[model samples]
Target: MSTSTGGGVPASRFLFLGTRAGHSIADAEYEAICHYAGLPTSRMDRVRLEEGPMPQIDLDRYAGVITGGSPFNSSDPITEKSVVQQRVEADMSKILDEIVARDMPFLGACYGVGTLGTHQGAVVDRTFGEPPGTGHIELTDAGRADPLCVGLPDKFDAFLGHKEAVRELPSHAVLLATSGPCPVQMFRVKKNLYATQFHPELDSTGLIERLQEYRHAGYFHPDELDRLTREALASEVVHPQQILKNFVEVYA
Candidate 1:
C-alpha cells in the first residue's frame, strides 16, 4: 500500500468549552471560570468558543465536552450577542447537533443551561429567575438519583453566579440539582447530556476574583459587592468542581 500522509488515530481528547459575552472580559473573569471547573485554561484541552455556533470536533478524538457561562442569555434580545456572538451561536448549534446525534458525552454550565434548554424546546423566558448570592445547594430527590449527583450528598456547596434559570425543564429532561433560589439548577437529557444552573467549575477564590472582575457586568450589584463577595469567598459549599473530575472519570 502507498504510504499514507496521516498516521493512525490519536487518543481521545477532552474539551473545555467557554464563551465570553459582551462586557465579559478575558483575563480574570474568564480564567477563573476555567480554573474553577478543573479545566486547564493554559492548555489545548481548553477552548473558549463564542455563544453562537461551534465547530465539528470528532467525538472519537475527544473524550467529552465542557461549557462555561456567558453574558448572552438564551433569552436575550436579538441584538445582545452582536454579529460575532451571533455567528458563534450558529456555529455552536451545528456542534451541539452533532453531540446529540452521536450521544456524545457533554456537560453544560450556566449559559449552557440556557442553550441546551432552548435547544431542547424548554421555554427560556426569564420570568421566574434572579441572580442570588452564594448559598448551600441541595439536590432534589431526582437530582440525588442522577449519576452526576449520585452519592454527592443530599446537600453541598457551589458557587452560583447566574442571571437566569430554567423556568421549566425540557420535555424529557430530568431534574437533577437545585439551590434555594434556583430550582432548575441542574438537569439531564438522553442520559449523557447534562446542564447545571450554577458555576460548578469554580471555587471560592476563583469566584472572588471573578466577582471583582464581572462585578459590574451584573452577577451582583456594586453596592452588594462587599457582602456578597465576602460571603461567597468564605463559603465551603462550592464542591461542584468535583463534578468536573466526576464527569471526566465517567465519560473519559
Candidate 2:
C-alpha cells in the first residue's frame, strides 16, 4: 500500500477510501480499482477507514475520491452497528459535506450508495437489496448521454450484492442506471459526485473471490457459494469497468 504523511496538500494523487477490515480483501479491492483505471497502484493513495479516524485529506491535492464497498450497511440500526462502522459513517458525512459543497470529483461503489444517499437525505433501506450475481442494468435516457456511460451499451451486466440500497434518489441527484430489482443502481450528486449500487471495479474473478470471502456474511446462502461462483464465472460483464476508467480519465 502507498503510504502518505497525513495533512499534505493534494497534488495529482487520487484518494481511495476503503472500509474493508480484512487485509487481503481490502488490498484486492484497491488493486482492482487501480487496475481498471489503468493507474499504477502508487498513484492512488489508499486509506483503510475502518482502522481509525479518517485521515485529514486535503481534497485539493487529489484528483478525486473513490470509495470501495464494505460490509457496513447504512440501513442497520444505530445500536446494531459496530463502533468502527459508526465512526466510519460519521467520517464519511464530514468528508461528503465538503465534497458536495465543492462538487468535487468522487465515485463511490456499493456501500458508497448508502453513504452518499444518507448524506443527501435519501431513503436508504433493505427494501432494495440484491442477491449476489450479475444483474441486468439499463441506462436511462439521461444515463445514455452521461460521459461516464459513454461507449457503454444501454443495457449491460454488472456485479452486485448488498443488504441495503437507496430507496429513492436524493432530490438533487440524477438517476443514471437502474436494475429491475434496484431502482437506484447509479446516480450522480451535483455533477462530479457519483455513486453506484453495483461494483464497477469488480469482474467475475473478483466477485468469486469476494463471494468466497464473504460467504458466511449473509449475502446469500452459504451452501450456494459454489453455484454462485459458477454463475459469476459464466456471466459476461465487460462495460462496467469503463466507468472506472472514465472517472480516472475525466478527473485524474
Q: Which stretches of candidate 2 lie over 4 Å from their true place?
A: 1-11
Which segments of model 1 are wrong by more than 4 Å?
1-12, 21-44, 51-56
How far in Å is the alpha carbon of 169 misplaced in model 1?
1.1
Q: Give the TM-score of candidate 2.
A: 0.96
- Per-residue lDDT tens digits for candidate 2, residues 100-139, read 8889898999988999888998999999899999999999
Worst 10 residues of 1 by lDDT: 1-10
What's the true lDDT of residue 128 in model 1?
A: 51
Best by TM-score: 2
lDDT of 2 at 141: 91
Residue-by-residue lDDT tens digits, candidate 1, 121-185: 78777665655456567888877777677447788877777767788886789888876577787
Query: How big is the RMSD of model 1?
Result: 4.3
